[model samples]
Target: MQLLFAAPARKPLQVDRHLRRQIVRYLTTCFEILSPAAEELIPDELEQWGQLRIGNGGDEIHARGYHKLRPDGRDAAFVRYELMVDQEADNPSVDERLEPESQYGELQHIFVLTIPPKTPKVNPHRKKKRHLLLAQIYEAPFKFDEADKYKVIWYKGKLGTGEVVDALTIQCVIDAGEYLYPYIPMFDSIL
Candidate 1:
C-alpha cells in the first residue's frame, strides 16, 4: 500500500522597490570603501555574468547584477543587489512586527551575496560554508521589545534557478520616517 504525507506550506517572498535601491546603494558603498579596487572590477565582472535589471520597482532599479561563478566551488556565485522598502502603511503593530516573522512594512533591500566554497591549498585545513546575502529593517512606531533590533531580520528568497535559499547576518533596516533612505554609516568611506 502507498503511504501519504503532508507537504509543508511555503511563505511568499515580497520584493519592494525602495528596498532594492537601498540594498544596492548600501552594498555598492560598502564595497567602494571596503575594496575600492573591487569596485572598479564590477563592470567587467558584471558583463561576463549576465544582464541585470530591477525586478519589482517602477524606476528600473528593482534588480541589479547577475550571478556568476566565483573562483571557488560553491552552489551559486556572485551577489544580487536590491533594496526592500516597508512603506509607512505597511508597518505592523509593535506587538506583532517585533520578530522577523509577523513584522510587516519592513522594507528590506537585500544584497544576495553568494560565495561558494573554496578548495584548500597547501595547508588543506580550509573549508568554508556557503553564504547567501540578506539584510533588512523592521520599522514600527512603538518599541515592542529590546531583543529584536530594528536592523537585521531573517529573510528568505528564491534564486534565479528556483532553488530555495536562506541568508543570515541580514542586519540593515530603515527607520520609521526614513523611506528609501538607508542609514549609510559607511557613506563617507566611499572615495
Candidate 2:
C-alpha cells in the first residue's frame, strides 16, 4: 500500500511587491475600458496587487517561451526564472536610436499573477482566466555598449533599493537566461 503520509516539497523563497503609483497607472493605460467594472477592478488607488503578494513562491504558472519558470512543465534542461526584454515584440528600431542598451533591464523573481475566476453563481458569463506575469527589473545604471544599443543581451545590473517588483509589461519580455552564469562571449546568451 502507498504511504499515508508524505513530506511536502521545499518552499521557494518569495519577494513581496510594493507596487508604486506609476506601475499601477500603466496597467490602466494598457487595457483602457473606462467602465465602472474596470474602475472597480483597477481603481487609481489600487496600490496592492492581490493583497501584497509575495514573490513567485511555490505558485507557478506558465509564461510563453519560458516554461522553466512554470511549476508544472517539461522540455527544460533546467527551470530558469530569468527573463529578458523581448526585442521582437517591442519597437527595436525606435529604441535603437533613442534608448541605451542597458536600459532594457533584467527581470528576476518572475511569477504569474492570475485573477481568480468568479464563482459562477451570478456571473456565469465569465470566459477564460486572466494571467499577468510580473517581475522586478534590474538595470545596469553604469554599463553601456555603443554597438549593442537597444539590443543588449548581457550586462551586470543592480536592483534599486526601493524598486517596485510588479512594474513589468507583457510586450517587454522575450525569453529566459541563466542568472549569475559566467560571462560568455556570445551576445545572444543574455536570455
Candidate 3:
C-alpha cells in the first residue's frame, strides 16, 4: 500500500534497479534497509535513542537513524530508501575507515531514481516494473551519529488502488551499519 507520488499526473516518473552480488559485497551484515514511510511509525522510540551515548569522546549522544529527509533537509547529501528483510544479517566487512559506526548497525542499501543528463522518452519496457536506481553513495564517519527517525519520510505518490499493481516492503536491521556502492556503467555500451 505504498504511495508512489504525491500528485496525479499523465506522465509519472518511474524507476527500477537490479544489483548483482558485487553490490552485496559492498554492504555487510548488521544493517537493514527500510522504507522512509515505514520508519516514520516508530518516531517516539527514535527520539529516545538520542539520549544514548557513544564514542570515546564522552557525553556524545546517539539517536535512532533515518534514511530520508524532509523538503528543507532535501539538500542532504544523499537520499535513502528501505531494504527490508526477515532476519538479521552479518556486520559489513568492508574496509573499517569506509564504514559507519557499529552502533548505527549495518543497514546500508538504498535505491533512488535519476533523470540522467537528458530525459529520454520513457520506454514501454522499462515501465513494466516498479524500479529504483542508485544515484549516489555515502561513506563512513557519517555526518550524523544516530538516525533521527523523525527526519526521514516515505514516498507519497498517488497511485490509487486500481492503478497500482504491487507493493512489498522488506525490513532489514543490523547491529553494525550499512554501505552503499553505486553501480558503475562498467562499459560504454552493452555491446
Counted clashes in each candidate structure: 22, 1, 39
TM-score of each: 0.22, 0.34, 0.18
Tens digits of per-residue lDDT for model 2, 1-191: 11111222133323233433323443454455333433344322221121111233321223222223434322111112223445554665554233212233434334334444561321233675555444434443333355854544444444343222343331233233455664311132223
Global lDDT of each model? 0.27, 0.33, 0.23
Residue lDDT tens for model 1, 1-191: 11111221132233344443444454454334333432322221111112122223211111112323323422121222223334443656633322233322232232334333441221123466433334343332222333644333222222221111122321221222212433211110001
Residue-level error in angstroms, candidate 3, position 73: 12
Worst 10 residues of 1 by lDDT: 182-191
lDDT of 3 by residue, 44-120 (tens): 21111112111233221111222333334322222122333333234455333342211111112323322222222
TM-score of 3: 0.18
Model 1 misplacement above 4 A: 1-16, 33-112, 115-130, 141-191
The better candidate by lDDT, 1 or 3, is 1
Question: Which of the two, 1 or 2, has more lDDT?
Answer: 2
Please state the error at residue 99 of candidate 2 in Å.
10
Residue 25 error for model 3, in Å?
6.1
Highest lDDT, which number? 2
